[model samples]
Target chain A: MAEILARTVEVTRKYGDVTALDQVSLDIRAGEVVGLLGPNGAGKSTLVNLFAGLRKPTSGRVELLGGSPTDPARRRGIGVTPQETGLPPTLRVGECADFVAAHFPDPVGRGELLDRFGLGDLAKRQIGGLSGGQKRRLAVALAFIGRPRLVFLDEPTTGLDVEARRTLWDGIRRFHAEGGTVVLTSHYLEEIEALAERVVVIGGGRVLTDDTMDAVRGLVGIRRVTLTASGLPELTGVLGVEQEGTRTHLLTADSDALVRELVLSGAPFADLEIRPTSLEEAFLTITGRESQAA
Target chain B: MSLVLTHARYQFLETVRVPIAVIGSAFFPAMAMLFFVVPFAGDNAVASTYATGSMVIFAVMSACLFTYGIGVAEDRAQPWDPYLRTLPAGPVPRFTGRIITVMGLTLIAIIPVLVIAAVLTEATVTVPQLLLGLGAILVGSLPFTLMGLSIGYTFSSKAAIVIAQVVFFPTAVGGGLLTGDPAYAPEFIKIVSPYLPTRGAVELVWAATTDFTPNPLALIMLAVWVVVFAALAVWAYRRDEGRRFT
Candidate 1:
């Protein structure tokens, strides 16, 4: 019910004979972290392009901040990082950051931004001299330069190392905690699991499911509860029961409730392990797009 | 103004980082002056003066066409241009900034030729003519600038390079730039030079710096080229935008 920062009203975008986006509609509200999960060619980038005012829908309307996405005034409050970006190789990192910063009315200071992205040491180095990961860090860093209310990051940590990915995650977390809405797309399920509270599964240019993180995970994966119990009569009637040598395994959608029932029944159990479903398992099941992207 | 200047400054920094780019633009004109003008017409005040103006126009034409045509096409392939285009500010400021940067390079490109003409040749011009020639140089460079933008937006970088080279040499030669004297020009050149934009551009520069009378027909043709290039530039921009983004 919060103010809608951006929305697509049955927007359809086409390129020649192919329809990149169908009559898909979505709304991104203020102060929300939404994850767009999909494989390659799922129209995730196409949809983000519409939100960022980079493209126009062929038929239905695309709106941003209560105006057309193409409007310059509305873009003042939005930030975006595309999937594949090649920074100007000759400009030094600090100079590049400052150049982008100058476009906004109230941009973050160059020095502070450098420090935040761990790019301080590379400040004087030309972008061409930096490693691929360093260049990606700079690209993502530019998105936050304008102190925007909403951000659209398309595969932000694609080429980053684990260490750099963690650092960027920290920055994203800090930004979100400071009341900035984030809309991110990623191939890595862990990335979505780490950041997004709401998940939208997109496949074939359609929204398959849009729900809370827990609910989406519940769809494709059945949580497994393993325990070693002696004389466990109550567990006999449970669904998906597999009896190992001295241990019992129960796979169910509601692991929390099953555990609580066991505890309330005064069953003697040792080493109870409740493992929630992994995002990868859920993604493959819900979208059935395993061969498309990493 | 500040934003445009910032764009210009950054663009300048980006290009100057590659020293060869600066060297390349200045090389041809200086070489033309040294080999063609200084040796043959250095002693003749009238011939050297007109040749000097023609070289200046030559430098301007190369700087605007190759720099914008190839540079814009190459930049279009990069991610930075799209990011900039999607910003809150429109492309006008950036376009103007790029033009200023290219003009700055054009001015620098002409300097070596000018210096060679002054030191080696007897090119004579009054103070008023000198200032007028500078003004004329900038104005005459307009059609070429637009032409560069048109070619750049219309083709890919590799294609742009080929297209620019294909169109450049013949136009320059057919326009009678290297022929020196009108009466001595090839029969084919004399017939076609009045219609080419380069002929009008170099004609204006010659009239500004020497005692040469401006050709009315060439001036009118030059105006027509300006309108044509302007229209092409606009068409290229809209087509590029609609094709890429929409």
Candidate 2:
């Protein structure tokens, strides 16, 4: 098992009357890409902020590199790119990179870092004149400049185009391939699927599920069976049912059992199709159940 | 030390690239020299010398207040500030960096006033007097710097700008910067002037450059203001840090 690089032990953080995180505990291990999948206002950013030392837990504790997150020495081993950031408008891209790099003990070369993010050609451009996507890429690139063992990126590719997002993902992948640990939060399920080996789903300031990608898939394991039918009797093994005009759709964890029941019931149906549901449907199911329970 | 310089260099670059920000602090003092001093007191060696000292203080006060106060507040308003705070260098390097940047800008701001005094007015000083006057300007700027830092850390950028402006004119007037010398100004100003930090600042410059006697009361008050403002600045900074980052 990999060593734990960062951890939040029963951490609870509040902003006056609102609780951003409630007894949320998580561990990020070395050389693993962990995805924090949550909807907006679900304490994803708050968790990242605590680990990055930008905020303190109202209770419990946050540790980074085996020490208190607030300590400067421990902070040096980690890097973070927040959801929103503004660079010095008048500064050139190269200068901005240098400024952040100077804070770290061993920083990556400026040109190499820029090239990794596809920003090599923009070294001389002032941040104010760069396109929004370009500025975002630069901001994310700076996080890697420090050569940190652990990196936390909160919504790293928000507001970026598909091409720009891919470029950023490649950069992140390269870092992970080099044995770097990463914890990134994103609502984009595909982003999590593409990068994360471990998945931690959060909702309503609580962890709905924490498991490997394959294990989480098995947990949801829902399959959608659609057919054109009328007045169909309710079937066993069905978790949910939806009617669209003459077509009926059934959601079930066991598609084989549901199919067997459907055939035995002698339901008059046509165009019968059964397929595995996407992760989107599973996430909705998990989060929806959480909200209802709360 | 290198970290401090790196932070200072970048911060200086950030501000100097915007030419208007540089010109804003120097405008009023240079204009005052032109409109009031050059036309009226330009020929009187003693009066012109005293007026020059007051305007230099005026320049220093504005530069310190606006540069540190509004600049810091505006930086806090940006997402970049929070990001920078998260870095591992702690606050000392950044704070020292900002002070260095402000000192450089302050020197730039006083140039226009100095040029006007040297060229159009009868303001004369030996080399030693000039050097001492420069040292006095640096010393005089301390209280304003602390006051500006307090306002900056305590308020948002919008409120900070208004507060700095509101504080600017009253100190200039009450300290007798615009009245040539407090002893010759209205009786009310004479009584109040010694208590203003600006009065102590200008008096130091006057004593440094001319035969004028420095007021013991004004100097004492200046020291008091520095201590008080230092405490307030620290409180404001700690309060802001606790509220935002814990």
Candidate 3:
């Protein structure tokens, strides 16, 4: 059992009559990458702010490293990349990283962190001159410069191109592999699916689901299965099924059972394939409908 | 302590980068003193008095208004406020840092301003009185600094600028900048002027040249205003904190 790096208990924040975050509680363990998936205004930013100690919860408690988030010692072990682009525009990329590094007692070498993030060439360039994706990359590099045990990244790859996004995704996976815990909130479900081991879906200031990536996908059921067969066996218990000529395509949670039943039915099949449900389908199933109504 | 020093160093460096602040603090006062030398060269009384008084008052205004007002406003404009709050040092160290920077800048500017004022305007003052005036000017500026901070926190940039202008110029004029004779002013003006920051500064400056003494009640009133503005600033900060997380 890994130690919990961050935890929240019934934390609620209200702005006058409006509740930005309702009684929300979550636990993120060490060396784990938890993806926070939600639409805009799903209280994801609010939760990140709470964990960062940028704002105190109106009710309940939040703990980072088993202490108040405001504790300097606790904060030293935590890194954050906010949703808003926070690097000073006038500062150079290296200067911005140095400024954040100064906050920690011991920080990783500037050259090493910059090189890891593919920002070594742009180190001396002013932040104002960088493209949006470059700035975001710089922000991520700064967040990791401290070598913090836990990191909170909110929309970390918002402005990145496809290639840059993949590069960041690889960096995040490597960070998690190195035993650093990361809690990330992003609109890119594919990115989350690629990097995060667990997905925590939030909507309207509430957690819709928190489970492993495979479990979350299972909740939405497998999308499609293609098999060439003379006659399709009955799939009454299966979720959805379709047949065309000698080919049968079925959507079911139990693809193995369906395949076995087809084999037992003595159907001639040339190609057999089962496509697992993606994180996008699961996210849509959980949050898409409610967000549309809201 | 290191955190406070670091913040103060950054703040002071930032202020020095501003051309307006540099001109207003160091240049304007020196220019004002130059006028005293030309217009009242023969009369030592007016020239000496105006030289020391105007220079000191200007220095105080620069620290209180430019340093605290503009500095606080810019800090609020940045993500620094939230960033600082999240840090272990918290707002207290950051606020203390700004005050330390303001005081240091004010002290450093005073030396050159007074030296230039004395040399150009042939201003003369006793060593004891000069030291006393320095203490008085620093203390008197507190209320205005607090007021600037209150305005900085309570209002947006446009509103704060308008209010600062509306209050600063009129108060500077009516509080004995153009005229040394407080008795010559209207009764209501005299009563109101005494409580203004300009009046405290002028009185402190006047105390350096002649045998004039500051009104104890007026100083008390200024102190009361400082307390009030400080309270208001604290309240505004708390309200802003509540809004941020909420």
Candidate 4:
């Protein structure tokens, strides 16, 4: 197994009466892309903060690179781009990059970093003059400036357009391709699909599932079985049911088994259609189940 | 040392890029010289020389207080500061760099007053005396710098602005900076000046530039203020860090 770069051992964090993370344990190893997927307030940012040494866990331990997260020497091995940031608006892009670079022992060259993020031409411009998308690209690009072993990005592409988001992703991918570890949080499932090999689903400050991408997709393998039928008896293995006039839609995990049962029941169905559910609907199904269970 | 210098250069560049920041620090003291010293005491060698010393201290006080107090508070409110804090290098280098930048701006701020005195007023000093006075001004500005840092770390930028203003004017007036000579100062000021840090700071400036003897009580009080403000500044810093990060 790759060396464990960062770990939280049954960590819990709270803000007064609100619990941000609840007895959560996770390990980030070298040379892997881990995606933290959740809704708005599901402790993703809290976990990132703990690992980055920005905040301490209320209970339990957080270790980064085999030492305390708050130690400066240990923190030198990791880079982080918070969900929101404000760079010095008056400084030129190259100047801001150089200022941050001087703090590291070995930093990426400003020119190479700018070009990698597709921001080569904006080097001379003041940050105040850049568009919001351009500024966000710069913010994410700064995380790679120190050539850190591990990078934590909290919603790295929150306010970016499609083209800009892709540019940012390419920069991140180049780093990971060079054997760097990445842990990113995003509500955009497509982003996780495009980038992460491993996914951790978080809800209500607890880890719901942690598995490989294919496994997660297979686990929530919900299919929409729609048919034009009426006066049918209750169906087996249907997780959810919806109706639109003469058509009935049944959400089922095993479409093959549901179809066989329907045929055996002799429901006299016509125009039978079975389509795979999009990842978005499947994710909603999981979270919806979680909320109902809670 | 190189890292500290780099931080100082960037911080200085960041401040100077906004022309108004430097201009604001230079404006009040220069204006005070023009209105108070040049017209009224320009012909009197002794009066103009003493007023020039007071205005130089005034410039240093303004530069240290506003730059450290308001500048630091404003920086705290920004995301850039927290990001910088997360870096491996400790806060010492950045803190030293910011102080150096403020000292540079303070030197720049005193220039207009010196120029106005040299050209229009009868203020004069030998080369060694002038250098000594410059050194004294930097040393004397420490108390105000610490005071500024305390307010900065303890309050938001909005509140720091009002607090700095409230703290500045009385110290300037009550310390006898407005009076042309300490002997000619109001009776109330004479009694109160020894306790204000500004009095000791200006007295050191006067002693450096002229044959005047600084009051021992004022110098002792100045040292006390430095210690007091230093303690307060450190407490404020740790309090802020605990509340925000821990």
Candidate 5:
């Protein structure tokens, strides 16, 4: 069994009258990547901050590495990349890592980190001079500098190009492969779909759903399937049937039985394929939040 | 302590690197003392006293106002506070580091200004008296430094600059540095002035130049100001720490 690295129970945070997080609980295990998904003002950032010990919950307890979250030793084992790129603009990439690394007992070498992030050429350049993508990469590099056992990445790939995002995804996978736990928050559904083994959906300061990607999609249910035939075969139990482009698309929870029926009917169909409902559709159906572009 | 020193060194370098702040706080005051005080070389003992006093206040103001005010804002703009808080040594070291850097920078500015004032105004004071004046000036600046800390933490960057100016000019004027009208100043002003950092600085310089003793009442008042301002700074810092992640 994987070790439980971080856990929170009934966590609630309030800023005066505004509730940022309410009764949120989560468990993250070693060597696993958990995606935290939410719309704007959905308490995603608040949850990440509480886990990182950057913010304290008003009414909950958090444990990091089996110790109090506030302990500096526990914090050293967890790295956080905040939503805002909190880098010193004037400091060079190398200097930024060096400064943060100074706090740790045995940090990874600067050259290794830069090389891993493909920032070798930009090491000597000031952060202000870096492009947005480069700055984002630098923040990610800094997060891993301490060789932390658990990492919290808040929108880690916000400004990256497609290739850079892929590179980061690979790096996260590598980190998890080495038995490091990662909690990631991203607006990109595909990023979560590709990375996270288990996903947690938050909305309005509360958790709407927490399950594996397949389970979440299952909750939304497969899109109803429809098939067309010339003889007008009896299809009484079908969920819904729609005609389009001179053929019928069957809408049903069971695609296999419908396809078997169509094959038995011997319909002159040119195209047929199984289509799974996307996580985005599932997210919209479950949370009822505004539909976001995939 | 070492961690605090590290932060202090960084703060010191950052302050010195800013050209506008360096010129305003250190360079301009030295120039002002040279051009204004040097030309009128005569038996004008009162003008000489005022010049010497004002130069010291100028140094303290530069340290407490420009350095801490701007430095704290810039530090907050980045992840410095969170980063520092994550360190093993905690926030006390960071605060100490800043205080040490401020004190060092104040001394650097004050010494040169004092030398220029002495040469230009032909002010006479022995080495022992000068050392005593330096001690008084260092002690007197604590309240103002704490005041600057409170201002830096309490306001946004733009508001901090405005607040610094608002505090700077009145303190300079009411403390008998610019106007030299302690008598004509209001009774409340006279009573409050001697307790201000500028007032303590001025008293130190005045005593050094004229071989006079400082009033025990002034020292007590300065001490009170230091304690109150220090409390305000701590309160502001704790409140800021709570909201940093927001």
Candidate 6:
């Protein structure tokens, strides 16, 4: 069996009245690229931060390299690129790489690291002078400086252009080819579809689904329910809810139970529309026996 | 050692590349020496020597406060800061490295002030006393360094800048840096100066270079400030970490 690189056991993180991550457990074994898929405020970053040892769980254990998440020694085999980092504006690109490289026992050479990230040309330029894409590339490149066994990238390509995003995909592929484990979070499902073999989907601080990339896509056939309601009521059997202006788009696989419960709640309401057409396509695709459900 | 030097080296390169930063910290003490002490005190050996001591204290204070206080706050806002904090080495290597860089820059920063004092004034000190004065300047600077740490950790970049200024000016004026002679110190300052660390800091500098006798109360207050600020710095660090990451 492959060794586990990092995992959280029944982890729940709370920030005062808000529970960011519910009782969530995840295991990342070596040589696997696991994509954490979630929308905004979905506890994806919280779990990633736990695995990276940046935060402690309120009621559970987070382990890295079979040791305490807080222990610095456990970080020897790990690397992380947070969602945003302001590089020292004055340091040269090469110098920034070298400064981080100095912390490791056997670091990749500065020149080679720059080459690996396609940052060779910008090596001598100060970080303040680099463009946004270049800065993002550099931030991601620093994670691989120590040849870490596992890397956690939080929204690594949120702002990169298509070409730059592809370039980064190539870099990630090369690392995976060398037998490195990667766990990354992203809002873009296409990014996950392109890069991940396995995936974890989070919503409302809970792991809604965890499976292989193909399996995860095949896991749910959700009906998008749109409703005009004055306020949110206690929800039951609803997958998730998205609020925009005066309308709410609700996602669920079971709409009959959801609609019954919504009507029973006795809240002030108006125009109500339930989307079963999209679900018909998904439900058919999942059942394997083709039917003209749409 | 190499790790520490590596951090220090980059920090040095970063600061020096911005000429304004060097000019900004180095200018005030030298200007004070030029405008405040050169004409009035240059004719007398005792007066000029003590004045130079006060200015030296001023230079060290500026370096430590801005370098650690504002520098740490600025770094706190950076992605690189959290990345470094997460490394297996913890924060010791980087912290030591930054401190070393600050010490080095502080040394280089005061050279202009010392040069002006040497050429334009009759500030005379034996080689041993000068070395001791330099040593005392660094030692007495600990409280201000801690104060800067607290301020940096407690505030954002813009807020840090404002808070540092608000702390810097009053402490300088209240502690006796702007006033050349302690004997000629104003009444309000005389009462409150002994309670401020800067007053204690300048006294130690003066004592190191001249026949000045520092008040026992000033030294005690310096110690109190050091302990309090040190605690506050650590608290601010923990508070930042808890609020942002954990």
RMSD values for the candidates in order, in angstroms, are: 7.5, 3.9, 7.4, 4.6, 6.4, 6.6
Model 2 docking grade: medium
Compute the lDDT for candidate 6: 0.81
Q: Where does model 2 exceed 4 Å of error?
A: A82-85, A159-164, A218-285, A291-294, B242-246
lDDT of 6 by residue, B1-246 (tens): 887788779888988999898888888888888988898998888888878888888888888888788888987877667677677776557666777777777778789888988899888888888898888877788888888888888898888888888888889888877777889878988998999999888888888888888899999998899899889978887677635653
Stretches > 4 Å off in candidate 1: A82-85, A222-294
Across A1-294, the per-residue lDDT of candidate 2 in tens digits comes to 889999999998888888888998888899999999876777787788888877888999999999987787898898877334578899999999999999999999999999988999999998899887888888888888888999888778878999988888988898899999999888777788889999998876778899998787677778899999876877887766778888888888889988888889998889999987776666666677677677
The candidate with the higher TM-score, 4 or 5, is 4
Tally clashing residue pairs in candidate 3.
0
**Model 1 residue pairs with clashes:** none
Regions of candidate 4 where Cα sits further than 4 Å from its true position: A82-85, A218-294, B242-246
Task: Using TM-score as the measure, name the better of candidate 3 and candidate 6.
Answer: 6
Each candidate: fraction of true contacts kept? 0.57, 0.64, 0.28, 0.56, 0.18, 0.69
Error of 1 at A182 (Å): 0.8
Q: Write the per-residue lDDT of candidate 4 for residues A228-249, one digit (tens) a residue.
A: 9866777788877789899988
Choose 2 or 6, whichever is better by DockQ: 6
- Could you tell which candidate, 1 or 6, scores higher by lDDT? 1
Model 6 native-contact share = 0.69
**Winner by lDDT between candidate 5 and candidate 4:** 4
Isolated chain A TM-score, each model = 0.77, 0.82, 0.76, 0.82, 0.77, 0.77
Poorest stretch of ten by lDDT in candidate 2 chain B? B237-246
Higher DockQ: candidate 1 or 5? Answer: 1
Model 2: how far is A235 from its true place, Å?
10
Say which candidate scores most in TM-score: 2
**Top of the candidates by DockQ:** 6
lDDT of 3 by residue, A75-133 (tens): 88888773345556656777667666767788998899999888899988877789888
lDDT digits (tens) for residues B1-246 of candidate 2: 999999999999999999899998889789989999999889988889999999999888888888888989988878888788778887778877988888888888899999999999988999999999999998998999999999999988899999999999999899999888545789888999999999999999999999889889999999999999999988897677635542
Q: Write the per-residue lDDT of candidate 3 for residues B1-246, one digit (tens) a residue.
A: 777777776666556656577556666556655564435542565545654675567666756775566656666766646655654456666776777777777776677667765666556678887787777777767777777787777666667777777767776766655454454557766777777767766776676665777777666666777788789878876666635333
